[model samples]
Target chain A: MLKVSVISPERTLFDGDATQVVAPAYDGEVGILTGHAPMMALLGRGTLRVTEAGGERRFTVEGGFLQVVDDHVRVVTEKAATS
Target chain B: MAKGRELKGRIKSVEGTRKITRTMEMVATSKLKRAQDRVVAARPYATSLAQVIADLYTPELAERFPLLRQPAATGPSGGRAAVLLLTSNRGLAGAFNSNLIREARSLIERLERSGAAVDVHVVGRKGIGYFRYTGRPLATQRTDIGDRPTAEHASELVQDVMRDFIARRLDAVYVVYAKFNSAISTPPVSEMVLPVTPPERKGPARDYILLPSAEAILSELLPLYVRNAVYRALVETVAGEQGARRTAMKNATDNAGDMLNILRRTYNRARQAQITQEIAEIVGGAEALKG
Candidate 1:
């Protein structure tokens, strides 16, 4: 499982354990799984889906970045709302 | 009788004032709590942005991005600066707006003394009114940002300044606002926001795969950093405004309570004196009639 955190300037939208995550990068969409190589990408405006144990959570995010390191994923966006 | 009545009226008025002040104090307290929470909520995004910048920043990258580089020369007549002053919309907050305006004035003066041409951009109604009253030229006057400042508001506030800085029309950008240290201590401070100061790197550089390119990422991050800085200042100013208003209202309420006590005591004393005078007059008339 990957520890995922979705943060916006207003609040933290989501933070928990996730099995898979997909984000809309500036150039394209990027997917992350556990033990993925460390990476950083600028986020575009689109939906970000995180698959947790209970269910799948989704957030509409815009204009920020995503970082992954040691199975820890951080999504910081300028604007984000749970959708 | 008239004196007693007058005192009673004064006491009633003070009591009403006390009630209003008390209500305002309570409102300010709740608003302050929410503002403080917003400040806390914004931290995660700020920290992550700083971390990403720290990881990606290099001396070589600074050379390519004008935002990361200091102005080459700031000699007299060579430097251009902009000061963004953040104040509150209303006037009830005691010394909150004044403190920010004072700090901004001094910062502008310092910049002028250094021979930098300073452009003033003001936010909030109080600051705009102050600049207009002083006949100081303002490049922009924005009054729309209220108690709640979002990232969009922040971007709007700083976009022009950032653009000018990049175009080499401005050498530096400073933001003057109240820094919320605690409930009791929120001091006005002036902070330089640009040209962007790269955060100190935290650890050995990791070879993370950079998507798109490092230059492209840095370019995007620089503006985000400025917007975040402005956003933080906006929230802190709001929190400080609420704190200041709460303290001011609390003091006003306490003063009104004291005044009410004094007025009540005076009214009672005057009433007793009037009763004593009326009895003396009646007894004197009865004694004269018996004689």
Candidate 2:
């Protein structure tokens, strides 16, 4: 399982365990799964999708950084909203 | 005695003044609480941002981005520098505005002595008023931010400074504001926000995938760093203002109460003296009539 958190300057949009996550990196879109190696990526203006057993959650984030460490993925953005 | 009546009127006025100060104190206390809450709420974003910046910090990365690049020298010809002075719009906040403005002036003077042209960006009416009355040239003057400044306001202010910095017009950017220490104490602080200082690497270095490139990430991260710094400073200044005001109003209320106490004592003593004199006159008249 992947623990994911999406935080913005205004508020936290999501925090839960997820199966997979796809985010818009500066170069291109990147996908992260459980047990992925630690990585740091820059986020562009695009939708971030987090998939879980329940459903998928989507948020639009701009100008943020994504960090994956020890099965925990953290998305820290300046601006985020439900998309 | 008429003196007793005068003392009673004086006591009434003092009591009225005391009521006003007490109410101001209560209002300032509530404002301080709200400002404190906002400062708490903003902490997470700031800490996380700092963590991200610290993790990415490397001397090489600083060289790659102009925002992180430190100039080799500072002289009159080094380039232009900007100072954003944060103060309060209202005057009742004790020495909050005065302290900040004084710090800004000294900062500007020091920068001038070092040979860098400084542009003063004045925020809040108090700063503007001081700069205006002193005939100090201001790059920008804004009084609309008031007591509560949002991230949007911070971004707006940052945009102006960043434009000049990025365009190579400004070599450095600094912010001067009151740093909140406690409800009773805040000190003026001058901080550099531009030519971002990368946090020193600590502990074991963890390898992470750098998407696009380190330079690209720095491009976005550096601006975000400056924005967060400005936003935090704005929030801190607001908190400091409210704290200073709370303490000031509390002192005023306490002083007013003391004055009222003194006035009440004087009134009571005057009334007693008046009564004693009237009693003595009655006794003298009775003795004279008996004689």
Candidate 3:
């Protein structure tokens, strides 16, 4: 499993080992998993879905950035909304 | 006796007001400290990015980028101009919202008079409210930017404004915000952003090298710069509001205290007079009884 993290300015929204992660990127949604190529992407306003070790956590984020490297997916968003 | 009663009422009202203002004063002070500290901490990261951009500058890369192009003053262009107007999310911070609104109105008027169309990018709720109410056109709005801000925050705003600039959706971009000087003073300032010109500085040159190309580094760093600048302004604005609120609350509390002091004196005088009159009445009654 890859390590997936979604962080907001005020607090860390989600941090766990994930099988796959999908986020709203600059243009559209991007999916990342273990052994994915390194990429830097811009994020937009939308939901972030992470399939974790045992459960999946979903977050709605508006604005910010995403960095995917070496089985580590990190998301930094301006604000996060959870349903 | 009547005077004492009136003074007592006045004192009680003043005391109540004092309590309220005192609480406000304390709240503002704590917020101000937090804002000031946050701004101070974010400086290194902002300035460091700036320094990197400065280092990235080269005579070769300077020639290629349209963003590096400079516009001469005193000319009206049919091209687009984007304005980044920063206002507070909430009010009660003395003239913070109005000052920016006034300036924005005047600029829009000037742009219209010059036959230039403008696109405004708003940063806070106040600006949003004003522009929406005034029926002005806004390119975008980033609302609810509160006490703490980060580079990530700046990046998003930068993306829109920068894209517009690059796409020629905007010919120029201007940032209007309060330049915080100290706890007591802050002034609204407008700066031209976009076209990534050589920063106007009266300092000595330093040695540096370009990481990729000057253009590449600049393009990469420019957004960060824009973001940091916005974040800085936001933090400063928050801090300034806190300072102003603190001052306003403190003044209110002090005035209430003064009023209470005056009322207390009057109340004491009235009570003493009433006591004296009662004593006289008792003595007169005793004399009559003796006689």
The fraction of reference interface contacts (C-alpha pairs within 8 A across chains A and B) present in each candidate is 0.81, 0.50, 0.00
Model 3's CAPRI class is incorrect
Tens digit of lDDT per residue, candidate 1, span B153-215? 999888888888888889999999999999779999999899888888887888999887888
lDDT of 2 by residue, B246-276 (tens): 7787888788788878878888898888789
lDDT of 1 by residue, A1-83 (tens): 89999998888988899999999999889999998999999999999999998889999999889999999999999889999
Candidate 3 runs further than 4 Å off: A1-83, B1-3, B58-60, B72-75, B131-139, B200-211, B284-291
lDDT of 3 by residue, B168-238 (tens): 66777777877778888877777676766564433555432222334554665566566667777777777
Ranking by lDDT: 1, 2, 3
Supply candidate 3's per-residue lDDT for B147. Answer: 68
- The C-alpha interface RMSD of every prediction is 0.6, 1.6, 8.9
Candidate No. with top DockQ: 1
Question: What's the TM for model 1?
Answer: 0.96
RMSD of 3: 8.2
lDDT over C-alpha atoms for residue B234 of model 2: 87
- By descending TM-score, how would the candidates be arranged? 1, 2, 3
- Report the candidate with higher DockQ, 2 versus 3: 2
Clashes of 3: 3
Error (Å) of candidate 3 at residue B30 is 2.2
